[model samples]
Target: MSTANTSNNTDSAIGAPVSATLPTLSRQDRDDSRPQQYPSPSSPHATSATSPPIPTPSPRNGRAGYQLSLPIPRLQRSEWVNLEGLVECALSSLGKDECTGISELGRGSHNSLYEIRFSDGTSCAASISNSPRQFFSADAKRSEIATMQYIHSSKLYKIPIPKIYSWDLTFDNKVGAPYILRECVKGKNLSEDGRFYRLNARDKQKVVKELAHVQAELSKPSEFTQLGYIYRQEGENGQFYVGKMATVPSGSDEEDKMRESFMGPYDSLTELWEARIERETLCAIGNWSQLPSDASLPSMLPPAKANPQQFGELQQLLSGLTNLFTPPEQLSKLCIHHSDLAIRNVLFDEKTLKITGVIDWEFASVMPLVITGRFPNDLGWEGNEFARSLGKFGNVSDGGVWNHHYYDWTSLSGVQPPPRADMPSPPASPTHSPASIDYLTTPNATANGYLFEHQASVLEDFDNSEGRAPSPPSPPLPPPPTSETSQQDLTSRATNLVELYYYRKFYASKLAARNFNLTRLFIDAVAYIKFNEIVLGGPEKWFASADWIKEVYWRMQEEDESAREDLMEGKGVVKVPEVFLAVRRREVDLGKWENKVMSMR
Candidate 1:
């Protein structure tokens, strides 16, 4: 092979203009698109704003741009939420006298949620999601925090609301995401309340009116506050839209065929702010794992065992849900609404059929306001579950099986979100943002809506839901391929490992060579390697244990210089310093997520 190692389009960050790609949960189905990092030529101050001398424009648009992705920040904003004196303060602020005192229940996924009991023993639930790092900047994060702060400060009036006890700066640190605390109100998610459908027409009308009222609250701009992403004013009238983003992601083989502009750095926090209203002005766009299989689809469907009428009803629901993804003219509009609106993400009271608290508001971006589907239509099946849980930063919503909402809980606090239309036409140019989204003008057709009731605060009836279904039985998929596909998969996996190692070494070299600070470089270096591990199916899996990583140091060797020369020749392998051998042997968190889940749960 030639000695020349081709850098190809190795320029990191979103090179050239890239298209959007979905990061679907299922590994195979993830977005092949890339993130766009640099500004376009049209912007007045585009040249002066960015740093690192914006790398070369991508040679093309569709390539993974993994070669062109920007360096993952060593400084990823830590999701920090810490609260001091939140429970007492929240109770005092609500100023209600139902019982004697409140004790802390365990937390849900996002905020450290708590249930406050009154003197007479009535209870309410509250959640507070706040953190340091980019909460100082992330528009969506700020949006959630600010919106809750607004409602809490005003005692969340009008609808049955969770009294936001307070949103104060408790403290900050590297480990824990900082947080604010609020009371858990008495309510249940409408989706879970089967009793809701049993309500008389008059009761249903009252519910509809309450729902309308919630939407009305969201319609006005004041109830919503700035999410804090930077939006720059662009175009004829100098309209402001979403500008720079704080959580701008770096490209990864984690991406596929197309380039994704998901990650990058913010030019300024103001840019993050300006990004809110501004249309996609220029700079644009932009986690994990596991699986279990299930039975034949026939059994999975309700019709398999049901009579004709039941089968027809099931078919309609399936068709309606399926139809959500059909292409349309207008894309979902983005505005300030409850980000965590999943069926599982709510609280309620049984008797009155009221909504108590809306929890989990994490991935709350001002994107197309898709109203119909309870879950994100863009995400595949696996992603839908994740979106319900991990997407929001506000409330905690796990699958319905382990839920406590079935009791007499009512979620009175409601929301007003505009319905989603088809994917909007591409931006007039290469810019698009939430404000640019146009769902208001497009007519949306009515689809089936969910009917349910308030939750009663009784002990969980989990036994019914839990043991009802047997463990999923797997079916044989297509037979394994000849050695060919398997080899390709292995080769691809190995190549990824090599490339991961190469990039880490390359990045370290870049940092040291440029005289970047060791602190920043150190953080970036570790993270870069971790990102690579994700591609290599992870290091912990490969190494098996941390002890192995330590034990294997300097022991693994290339059998010959020819192998070394090959890895180096075409792939910049020749330049790799010997120190990387040592780097690979270093031990770090092997099963952070598993450990975290077990301990935290």
Candidate 2:
């Protein structure tokens, strides 16, 4: 929909335990013109060739919002939406006389939003997906619509979720691009007001309490029937698929292969996790099976310092983790998580600190508590002691303090959670509230006989380690002596290993994308080992140390570039551009700093 889209960077990888961020609402320059009649739906007309020019927002403003209406410079290849066509389509669909004002609402990596006010003073938001290269897919748009519809139908949460009036998945709908029209939820976004950090402790706590209660409501297990994307099936008799894995078109022949199966709406959380683990394992071993005959590691590798014994130990540990978390019995319970609860997505009134709405449900999914238990990464603040002290500013779910607020609110609001079928009856303790017990403990604790206290400790340690922040906690790597580990040990180790694997995989993917040749590093044993070692340090440490790895890669990159230059010079080829030559010299300097890091290590 044409709702605000936050541009904050957030983790939204499938099956990854990362937080999400959406687009932010940018302040708009008020249009001086009076309200105009809404375009008639019966005889819609797009702006003429000489239609009065739409005023573009000035760039002098510090905040650019999501999409800058200013035409991107010629060399910039970023996708741009056909806003004129979208405006015409939206106005036509609404059947309003003519829009009084249509202004850029926000922009995000994948979509751009515009607010359209009808002559009658009513308005709606329009979200147009960036064509040719969309961050989100057709299935994702469908799932988002389904999520909002489902949430609206349930009336489970007190905060407002915008209602989706209509949507066009493909440009075939005369809009020339995919767009969603929904009710324009009024009230300034928290980011726009820049008032989040200004609230009093009492108000901040109130926001946290409200957030926790909303989380509790969203996480109801009974509401979702299965694990996967939600959508409505085709045909007149098509049924709504709440928990079905969605499939979408892929590859060059998008139309013919439209029926092709994509990944899945996994049957269980274990199945989804295994699919990811298996995919990454392939990047390491290539096509070689784990047969004794193929005992040697692949040869497409560079020499490294990793010991074979340690490599084998880690590999075994990772494998044990895959098997350990594979079974349903050992898995945690599943529930829907917003997945992207960053500040941009949260809407609230600064006066009361009461949240008015939470937007962008596109990434919402049914995931395990292990994935959804922590606060969003974007919400983490390590250096700012003042921000950390406020329950709303720092991680709300930290230390179970937010959980207490959530429980208290649930009790006061009379929002009863459906009984967890898996939880065991606690020893008679009148003091322990069921909500408190439920919030603190996990399904794994109940199923595996792990103590509630132990579950809390592990989850907290885990959030501290893998979660993003200025200086995340060092990975609480399981105590030494990797031999003779138990199931619980494997579980603990597996969680970290999974987190580490994804962490390295994310960077590795980035390197490959930036320097296509670096993809060869995946086969380079030395590179692979160093990459894992980096992530093994946990999020903060790994991120801090990443410059070293990038330096080595870039040095090798510059060397290759220099060799290319020499070949061209020897062949009497054209001289290289001074700009290119200067860039190479700077790269060489960067390599020196990277070398320093290695020397110290």
Candidate 3:
């Protein structure tokens, strides 16, 4: 999913929100691509949940052609062929009033979305997925449903997530795919409705705060189906088990022992997601290129012998062997996920500006644990990426070790693209260069058919406080000293946010690292660096302030050979090379400054 970005820094976290001095959005652009039909299927919210008929909003600006309905016949597939039947069953389970209409919304990389409206006009969302195969296995699908169910069943899970009105599967399909249905969630999808941009800073901050809460709650994994928060403790056995009094329900002693060995603590929702990704990534690596991924990293990890005979047997039935590996010890492993936890997937009220709901579930999964920072530019506007190499290659333990590949925003895209008409404003700006981003395509793997894994500190730090809240609405900010938000009570919230950044940076960096090209880092790191570039330049630069850039620029400029020599020796610094070129382009868009700098060359 490549996105075309705009110079809209409205949500660029380094500073306060302002009337965005944005490049014209594609909404106004003449798209020469194929005639796009934002086909909204007829899966409206179940009639049981409807509040009132929100007659399709009059076309914006009197544009009469945006139809609220697409004639594509619903439930055409033979497997999920009888949605009406499933709907009936769901209606029965949800107390016939739980549904109003099942209108189709759209689809994603893995599932089909349906809107379920109840009779009250209030609605929730529903999804009907094909046989959960490939990236989404049935168990994982069930797990997601279970995760949702966990939310619906808990008290702390008061994040406005859509409730599962009912879930049905025409189970006869290992033959095809399974069917899932949920209720419709109301409010403007900031991704879809442009009105969200009009929100005042107070509302935006409130939205972000609530988002942090939901994320934290979602990350807490409890034994019973609880969503938001889950407190846990070890049971009689030495194994880590989530028990009563404070935690959600746990499995039987046997199940607990078996799962506890690998899953780690189910104390938080993110911990579970993190644990799951580790196991999934662990099991995900299986001869994709068939060149034998594990063959090279033999000395890197523990030896696990897979039966060659067993491998030979499965090779016949499989296409791309993406193994769904089970965890050896339930408590030790975590999942690979978008550590970046922003309100990119949320919607807000047109009047109140309060968040309606959060959406994007694509990067949500059980993945490897070694991933540190995904998106390098997610940290406010300053392009900073961090990672935990997990000592896979060394004898070290834990994942906080740093492999310093310094330099800011030189590798990737500079200004971030504007928020898509279809997605919420992404939390971070990719301040890399224009050439390309150095993101990862494949999971890191090893010689014994193992994939490289790292711990995501995301879920563990999902809590939030005053600092994490959006800055108060004010006139554009005057330069201020750096305020430490390191302890913003962001327990799992920060961790999730970290994972998102980690994913972005990892893929972008790996993109650069792949061909052994350090420029790749520059390519992806550029957007981030550019944000910093603007930060360096201070207010003189529209994309950023001009003061910061001038400072960095002067720091790097060689005043004399002695000064350069001193910088080279790490003594008196002539300049900071970490300031990359891609970032300089942000506020210097006119090139007037660039040409003048070239004259100095």
Candidate 4:
């Protein structure tokens, strides 16, 4: 990483640029593709009389400048941002005399990050939310600061959280935007670190174990009675309290807009669901009427307006399914969850692979343990197509079954198994095949058994010694060991599959050993549904079929019955289709969709 300051401004903040010493850029830094220059603070762009333009860095390479772009016209603003003012605010907060330089660190969906270096050799990260509407609430910045402070002060978890030095929730400050200045966590994001993917199965398991432990610790304090955003109360010694749930902004600048920005600190999960459904219903109806016929709508919005009565029907259906969405009493308690636990949000040491800090708590909120508990996004088998294919054979938690299936195929085909110390011994009965192994006896297995058997048959096709006629699967199998499809490629794929199985198995076991209740909640089907609903918007937006409302109602009924039977029989777990657990796919698809829409804009 380049330590030299990238900012062009000299001693004076928000003043004419002056000549200063510049560091030589490394080859890597010189080749970096992101825009590097910050717009001059003294730019001649006129500011709105009512609200000054939020300063943003402009690209000198003639590319589109980094700015908050939204579908809402009223929320769109100029790309010019007061970078010098932001640096000055950070310096003032840290009690620094002079700034060495400021450089853009990165940009996320909602915030832009910068690293500001001071003359004293100290640096801090500033996360600036370019638009208050990002979170659909004005209190987004304040709530985030409060959440970070509460977690940092509590010291209840082993994971490191950044310390907030200062923050502004409004554009009243010189920064001209809401920003949080905090200690710069001295580590690289786990996702950005290439070394992580190169680790052996055992080492990868260690990382997964640590992440699971962090999640277990976060679930320790689950006594919160209300489901909402945490906020710090007013006064000199104000305490944190669970407050209204943040929702979409009403797009009104009036006083009532603030009130509408949040919905409720619901007493129960049902109430929260009801509030959410109602909000989405209204938003859908409003969008249907307001948007032009030819205008492109975000995926979250309905494609076309339904019968006015259908909206009510959808709301009622969701309202009645609340119980199905609710977990058992033990797992119903609310706990703080980092809803977006992507690898990019996690910081870790490159040498030891120990997690240093977790950032981006803007979306963190109190929610039911069932909904909060799950494997972190990076640990899930969503992005890797091979891993996802393996998932078709069994549940993610059934690592032993996957291992057995892999070994069964490799043994029959006379292929050597990958060198893995963690690989479990094959099934005791050598004759046991994927079709015969009863890893899960639940209805879920029966529902997906055919797919599993089909995959098993395809693997059998690789072996011809039995003289059985080959029945290849739809996705054609690789031709026999060509240069392009060598044994090494097959072995590599098998290794990846085995590693994912072990990683998930280890993660689940770690959660169970640390907190069994959390493990139970982690696998709860209804909880995954609720989590997906939050991420991909309401179920209404999930499909284009007009019968989606009806489909959701029927599916909930079936799940509810299955859950009841499992509990009655002491099984204690509700299993659903793999599609419900495909969170990574939904998230990735949404990102791509959003980016496409943004480009169109």
**Which candidate number has the best lDDT?**
4
Instruction: For each candidate in the order shown, give its overall lDDT on alpha carbons.
Output: 0.27, 0.39, 0.30, 0.46
Candidate 3 residue 51 Cα shift, in angstroms, is 7.4
Q: Candidate 2, residues 176-267: lDDT per residue as tens digits?
A: 56778776554444433234445554554455555555655654453555666666565323455655443222333532132223235666
The TM-score-based order of candidates, best leading, equals 4, 2, 3, 1
Per residue, candidate 1 scores C-alpha lDDT tens digits across 210-245 of 443443333233322333222323222333343322
Which is the winner by TM-score between candidate 2 and candidate 4? 4
Query: How well does candidate 3 score on lDDT at residue 180?
Result: 55
- Poorest lDDT segment (10 consecutive residues) of candidate 3: 1-10
Question: Which candidate, 1 or 4, would have the higher lDDT against the true structure?
Answer: 4
> What is residue 341's positional error in candidate 3, in angstroms?
3.7
Instruction: State the TM-score for model 2.
Output: 0.48
lDDT of 4 by residue, 47-119 (tens): 1011112232222221111121111122222253456456556544555544444555544234556665544
How much lDDT does candidate 3 score?
Answer: 0.30
Residue-wise C-alpha lDDT for candidate 3, range 248-304, written one tens digit per residue: 112234433433443343443334334433432333243123435433322212212
TM-score of 4: 0.60
Order the candidates by lDDT, highest first — what do you get? 4, 2, 3, 1
Candidate 4's C-alpha runs over 4 A off are: 1-78, 132-137, 193-195, 247-262, 284-316, 381-498, 525-536, 542-574, 579-601
Candidate 4 yields a Cα-based lDDT of: 0.46
